[model samples]
Target chain A: MLGTTFKRIIRAGVVGFFRNAFVSLATMLVMMITLFVIGSLLFMNAALESTLDQVKDKVDINAYFLTTASEEQVLEVKTAVEHLPEVMAVQYISREEALVIFKERHKDDQLTLQALEELDENPLGASLAIRAKDPSQYEIVADFLEGQMAVAEGEQQIIEKVNYHQNKVVIDRLSGLTASIETAGLAFTIFLTVASVMIIFNTIRLAIYTNRDEIEVMQLVGASNWFVRGPYIVEGVLYGFVAGLFTLFLFYPLSIYMSSATESFFGSFNSLVFYTSNFGMLFKYIVGSGVVLGAVSSFLAVRRYLGV
Target chain B: MSDSLIRFDKVSKFYNGGPAALDAVDLDVKHGEFVSIVGHSGAGKSTLLKMILAELYPSEGAVLIDMDDTQHLSKGEVTQLRRKIGTVFQNFRLIDSKTVYENIAFALEVAGMGDEEIEVDVPHVLGLVDLHDKAEHFPKELSGGEQQRVAIARAIVIQPSLLIADEPTGNLDPINTYEVVQILKKINDLGTTVVLTTHNKGVVDSVGGRVVTMDAGKIVRDDSGGQYML
Candidate 1:
């Protein structure tokens, strides 16, 4: 008995979905737009964060060591800085490497290259470049490095200078900009989801209104509430399921089409690659939200309008 | 235990504190009886039928279907009570999206009948209506008479203990009306208590059983042998 009731409701819903083709299509189209907007936000966030990462990569504290400091002393300082929770990485450029880099940078300036080659010995110090996970936490890494510089290493004063102060202003501004963008994106996504849910609810209410007589007839005939309401819920789920799948398909071509532009604009963040790689997560969200929105809106609309 | 399929005890139904839709009325419909309710518009024929269906509760007094008080039945109880009684309206009220066969099958489906039973019962009812050829056809494809017959088929397919026809033939022509009335008589003969409300004297005369006359929300007269009195 339970099995037959369930099958009948599902069949009725499937029949209703196809029989009312115009309304069903209109519903699916609107839901697709909602899912598409949400999916686009996911891609946009990826691109934005990647661009921010590029900016974060450019600003790090560089500590120059004294020329007399041995490689072992500098290596010890590198390991200590790497142990800091906030520090992402530390790179050591030896005196020879630093001199080579300086010469390469000034190769276009013949006078500077001559000046560099005329030195009695390489005056450049070995340096450590320290990067922090969060641009805002660069200050803590800087303070830690300063404390290391003060240790004196047996009164030799091996650390000559640290350049965090010069880069502090730029890092702080970058951090603030990224933070504001993320907060704003979250708020905008929330607002869009609420609006889409309202639109779906109203659209379904109209569908129920059109079927009001059928609903009344069903009720008057003594169909159990679930029997009367079940078909509508099934139709709602189908609307969401199909729309979610279609929206996913819609993104495939769109992601591929825009992959080149996004890659060039966001500097190696490809939309197509992100879409395929994250397809499982995206399906869970887009399809899941679609089903949730469709079923919930229909459920609520029938409750409010049908009163059954 | 009164052998009454429906018993309305001192029922008074007034809407918005205005004049009563049904005013302090009492009536009984016995088991296996074909009773036709005849009255002009506003005579409370519709309201009284609605009471039996539990669509409306009495403002005063009580309505009992098989000794179960309608006004006190919970929502699920109301539904269970409704399933025992089939209702047909002036409008055919067929789900247009469904075929004629599906329309009849829908009644049994809601009753939780198995598919094998539904498959057999739907075709039997379609054959009785002589719409076996039109089973796959949509309601819109059928004539007015055919649609009314389909409505009757849907109502009776559930084998409801009591069938209420509220102006079931209101939309049909003479030929279709005769066809529908004949079908109702056939269903009543098969032992399902039938309560029908109509404005047609021809329908009352044709039923040829019991007629209850109402005026201004009161039963003015009731007679056996289905005499139509206006």
Candidate 2:
């Protein structure tokens, strides 16, 4: 019995949807626009988060050692720093490797190469590069390195200087900016979602209003509230289903176009890979939200008229 | 009271403290009886029908369908009650989008009849109304009488125990009116209690059944085997 009722409800919904094609299409278009705005915001936030992570990964405190410092001494400091919970990684760069990198970086600068060759001995110092798990933790790591330098014996202060001071201001500003952007993006998305819900509610209400005569007839014919409401809720879900499909159709190409358009800025950061890996979750969210939005709006819209 | 299908006990309906749409009135309709309610435009004939259908609640008294007071019925129960009573309006309120066959089938569908039954019963009812040839035609394409027939077909498709026709022949010509009255008489003979409300003396004279006349929300006259006498 329930199955038959469900079939009838589905049939009614399908008939109503097609019976008023213009209104149904208008509703679907509105839903699609809502989904599109939400999808774009989500994708933008994801790309922004990925880009910020890459930038943060590049930020670390570099500690230079005096030429007199032995390789074993630098390795000992690297191990000590590695033991700190804040330290994500510590890499020791020898003077020879630093010189090779410097030469490669400035290979096109003949003047710089001549100046480098004019030196009698390698003036470059071995350094330890310390990466912290969080940008805020960099200060603690820097303080640890400073204490190590200060406590060194008077005749052999092997640790030269840590570049934390030079990098601190920029890292702190970037972290603060990213935090604010994330907060603001979340607020904006929520605002858009609420506004979209209202629009959908109104659209469904208008659709029901257009069918008021039909609803009256149904009521007079002894259709129960469920019987009258079932078709509209089904229509709402249909709107959502179609809107979800449209969002996916529009999102895929839009994402690709955006990925390429911003390649010069974000290409080296592997933003495309980030989207591809998380595509499944994104797909589920967009489609699920569409269906939920459609169904909820429809249910609320038709509730008042069902009193008949 | 035991055999009554519908009973109005001191029923009164008022709208916003104005004059009553239905005054304190008492009436009973027994099972398988043909009752005609005749009155002028504002005589509360429609309101009286609505009370029986549970579309309107009494302001002062109780309306009972099969001895069950409608004032106490739940919304679900009210719908259930309505399913057993078929109602036809003057405007021939057929779903404009549906064809004749679909219009009748919709009533059966609302009663939760299965597809096979609807397929069989719809054609049977359409044949009874003699609209078998216009099964697929929309309401707009049909004449006024044809439209009323479709409405009648929709109302009776569920084989409701009670059929209420409010001005069913209002838009029909003399020939069409006579045909509709004959159909109502035939349906009454088939053991469905029919409550017809009309101001047409010809309709009341033709039915020649129990007639109740109302004036200003009160039943001023009721006669058995009577004609329309305002």
Candidate 3:
């Protein structure tokens, strides 16, 4: 009996959905828009994360050493810097490598090449490039670098200069912007989710309202509450399922269009690649949300307005 | 009262502190009896039928259907109670989207009848209403008499012990009304207790059975094997 009733309810629901062709179309369209909002937010968040990572890569401290410092001394400082909690990595540039780089830059300038050849020894200093885990931690790394004392003389630092203070303002501002963007992104996602549910809910309510007389008749006919309500729940779920499929298709073209712009700006992040690679996860969330939202909205609208 | 299929005991209903729709009415309908309720507009005929269907509660006193008090039945119990009684409306409220066969099948479907049973029973009920050929047609395609016949088919498909038809022929022409009244008489002969209400004296007088007359929310006259007289 339970199985029979369930089958009848499902059949009725499907029939009901197609029965009111215009209302069903309006309902599915509204659901598509809602699901689209959610899916677009997923892609936008991926792009935003890629851009922030690219920005974070640009802020680091370059510490230059004196000409007297040995390669071993610089290598020792590099190991020490790597051991720091705040430091992410350290790259040691030898005096010869630095000279090679300088010559490469000045190769176009004949006067600079002549002046450089007149010197008997290489005058370029070895440098250690320090990167911190976070942009704001660069100041802490600078403090650690300024604390390094000279090995040969008192009050004479072996490190010639650290460029962290020069670019400190830019790094700080970038860090602040990244934080703000993350917070705002979360807030926007929540607000959009709430608004989308309500919009879809009202649309469903209106659709169900059109069937008020039918529902009353069904109730009057001694239909169990579930018998009356189950078909509509099925209709709601159909709207969600179809809309989810449409929204997924919508993302394909949208992601493809965004891929080039994202690749140019974020350097390595392609929207299409991200979308394809994460299709399973996206399908699980987007379609799942669509089905859940559709069912819940219909359930609530029926309960509150029609008293079913 | 214990043997009565439906009993209304001193039942009174008021709406929003207004005049009573049913005031201090006590009536009992026995098993397999065709009871016709006759009254003018505002005579509380529809309200009495609504109470029997458990659609409204009495402002005071009690209504019992086959031993279960209407006021105290649980939601599930109410559905079970209603399953024992069939209701018809003046409008012949058939589901417009459904075909004639499906409309009749709905009553059995709501009762959780299986598919094979529905397939067998829907055609039989259609034959009873003499609309078997139009089984697949939607309600909109049917005439007034045909629509009311479909409504009767839906009502009796459940095989309810008591059928409460509130003004079943209100919208029908004389010939169509005569056809509908004959169908009701046929249903009553098939051992279903039918309680009907109507303003048309000709339809009521034709029934020529027990007639209960109401006026100003009260039963002014009740005649056994009587005519429709206001």
- DockQ of every model listed? 0.70, 0.66, 0.63
- lDDT of each structure? 0.89, 0.87, 0.88
Error of 3 at B181 (Å): 1.3
What DockQ would you assign to candidate 3?
Answer: 0.63
Kindly list the per-residue Cα lDDT of model 2 for residues A175-256, writing each as its tens digit: 7887887899899989998888888788888888877787788898998888878988898888888888888778766657
Q: What TM-score would chain B of candidate 2 score versus the native chain B?
A: 0.98
TM-score of 1: 0.94
Best by TM-score: 1
Report lDDT (Cα) of residue B130, candidate 1. 93
TM-scores, all candidates, are 0.94, 0.90, 0.92
TM-score of 3: 0.92
Per-residue lDDT of candidate 1, residues B148-226 (tens digit) = 8898899889888999999999988999899899999999999999999999999998889899999999999989885
- Write candidate 3's Cα lDDT for B1-230 as tens digits: 55799899999999999999999999999988999999999999999998888889899989989977899988888788778788888999988878998888888889888888899999998898899999999999999889999999999989999998999999999998998899899999999999999998998889988999999999999888999888
What's the TM-score of chain B for every model shown? 0.97, 0.98, 0.98
The residue ranges of model 3 lying beyond 4 angstroms of the native Cα positions read: A67-86, A113-122, A147-156, A305-308
Q: Chain A alone, model 2, TM-score?
A: 0.85
Tens digits of per-residue lDDT, candidate 2, B72-99, equal 9998899889889888889998888777
Docking level for model 2: medium
lDDT of 3 at A18: 86
